[model samples]
Target: MTSRFTELVVDCHDPEGLADFWCRVLDFKVIDRGEGKVEIGSWVPTVEEVRARQMPPTLLFLQVPEGKTVRKNRLHLDVSPVDRSTQDEVTRLLGLGATTADVGQDPDASWVVMADPEGNEFCVLRTLAPQE
Candidate 1:
């Protein structure tokens, strides 16, 4: 059996603000909201709680008192464009407030390093494999 990904949770100081930033970046929407917690998801709501609970759940941004740090990231996401060129997608993400991070990749490499608004690192790659 294979497991399906329900969501990716990010810990941050400002949950709502971070959720808004990611929603804009990924075209995701807020599915659930609670005190110091915000969930954003890519899929539309299904059940009553998901629909009426007033919280987003695609990706959750949890509020933490400490500032964000990148000493190490156990998990990171790599995004790619559907039809647009990689260069174009990188430019678009940059415009959306993502900043470049120097990860020591060759200049000619197809993937570009970027950090989210909360300083979490991710990548925008040149290619995406076909969906199963």
Candidate 2:
């Protein structure tokens, strides 16, 4: 058997803020909360695992020292709106403080690459049919 991919984790100085931003972006919820950690997941886990058996399968938002620069994102999320045009979504995100990034995409293209408030780059692609 081979290992499967799991959740993506992000390190941030403001855990609550990042978690809230991601919740807004993905329409997900803050499934778990702690003093210095927060978790966001697409779906809630139903099974309870004991001790080391638990997989801890959720995107972790860890608190770090203030004024920390994000050297590289160990993981990033690409977001696209479900029922809105990509242009509209990009506009909305920009209004929400996301800015353009240097992804080498022409300005006329259907997809726009943007960085979140913390400078994490994510792509907003033109709408395609949802995968089954």
Candidate 3:
């Protein structure tokens, strides 16, 4: 049997806060919360959907003592706008607390680097459905 990608866990100081930020960014909703963990994803799937392996991977924010000490992220996510232009999405993210981060990309790079509230870097790519 082959394994399917499921979830991505992130270490942060405030799980709920980070989850909230990501939920707004990704248009996801909080699905679960525990002592120090907050799980967010697209709306919960039915059992059949889960069995069919059709669920998008969820993000679980875990609280950690030594949170985000690194200067840069070793692994980052790249997101594309679903219904809006990349520049509009970047503006929306900035309004939601994401800050522009410079990881020494060339001026003509196709992606924009931005950091979440906990300083995790992610890139915003072109819109998913390009205008015709």
Candidate 4:
């Protein structure tokens, strides 16, 4: 038996705004939208079609009243560039409302730590090698 990772839920102050930021960052589209939540992921498989095949986990942004504290997150995401250089992708993410984040990482760290508009931390790693 195997388990699949289907969704990553993010708590945010503004679900719609966060969803917009991530859509641009991931080149993803909004798959489902509701009063206080939005789901973004690949556009190929409609939400209803997701069960038919394996797919990357979708991001679900849910509205929350409390703001993020300065404490380090228990969990964070690390992303790698698929086609562009890491620096370029970091710049693009910055232009899309992400900001540099300091999380006690060593100055020589290879990945760039960044935070979304709502202050959720994620990392941009070096471009990954092509799969064989």
Candidate 5:
């Protein structure tokens, strides 16, 4: 049998806060909440609905006692716009507490690097062209 990617767990100081920020960024909703953890994914009214649809992997935020100390993240997420321009999305994300990040990328790079409120690094890529 082949393996399928299911979820990505993020270690954060505040699961609720991180989940809230990510939900807004990804247009997702909270799927589950447990002690010190929160799971957010594509907005589905119920688990049954989620099961019925082919959904992307969910993000789980787990509360941790220690804060992030790494200057650069070993693994980061790259987001592409669905219905908006990359600049517009970057502005929107900045309004939501994401700060501009410089990761030694070239000045002409097509993607913008940003950091979330808790200093986790992520990138916003240029939107894909329409398929014929």
Candidate 6:
């Protein structure tokens, strides 16, 4: 028996805005929506191929009155660019409303800590070759 990730449910004040932001960041698309939630799924062929056994996990943004807190999140996402350099990707993300974030990490760390428009923290990992 094996288990595969199917969805990542995120609580947010504006499901529409978060979905838009993540869609651009991940090259995803808004595929579904409900009364209080929006689901974003992948459009990348490689990503879909990697999850051939089933569909890849969708980023599900659900409605929440209280948004992110002042304290850091217990869990955060780490992303790697498939084709572009890490610095370029980070710069593009910054242009898309992402901001550099600090969470007490050593300055020499490889990953770039960043926060979304809603202040959720995620890391931009080292870039990977397209073949990777």
Question: For every model shown, what is its TM-score relative to the native structure?
Answer: 0.77, 0.74, 0.90, 0.86, 0.86, 0.85
| lDDT tens readout by residue for model 3, 31-80 | 99999999999877566666677578899999999967778789999999
Give the runs in model 6 whose Cα sits over 4 Å from its true position.
Answer: 1-3, 43-54, 130-132
Best by lDDT: 3
Q: After superposing candidate 1, which stretches have Cα over 4 Å from the reference?
A: 1-4, 45-57, 127-132
What's the CA error at residue 45 for candidate 6, in Å? 14
Return the lDDT, model 3, position 111.
91
lDDT of 1 by residue, 50-95 (tens): 5455443368889988875655466888888775777788888888
What is each predicted model's overall lDDT from 0 to 1?
Answer: 0.78, 0.73, 0.89, 0.87, 0.88, 0.87
* Residue range 79-130, candidate 5, lDDT tens digits: 9988788898999999999999987889999999999999999999987645
- Please report the TM-score between candidate 4 and the true structure: 0.86
Which number leads on TM-score?
3
Question: How good is model 6 by TM-score?
Answer: 0.85
Error at 43, model 4, angstroms: 4.3
Ranking 1 against 5 by lDDT, winner: 5
lDDT of 6: 0.87
What TM-score would candidate 2 get against the native? 0.74
RMSD each, Å? 5.6, 4.6, 1.7, 3.0, 3.2, 4.0
Deviation from native of the Cα of residue 49 in model 3, angstroms: 4.1
* Winner of 2 and 4 under TM-score: 4
In model 6, the worst 10-residue window by lDDT is 43-52
Clashes of 2: 0
Number of clashing residue pairs in every model? Answer: 10, 0, 0, 0, 0, 0
Flag regions of model 3 displaced more than 4 Å. 45-51, 130-132
For residues 54-99, write the lDDT of model 6, one tens digit per residue.
Answer: 6567899999999777668898889999889899999999999999
**Order of all candidates by TM-score, from best down to worst?**
3, 5, 4, 6, 1, 2
- Lowest summed lDDT over 10 consecutive residues: which window, candidate 4? 43-52
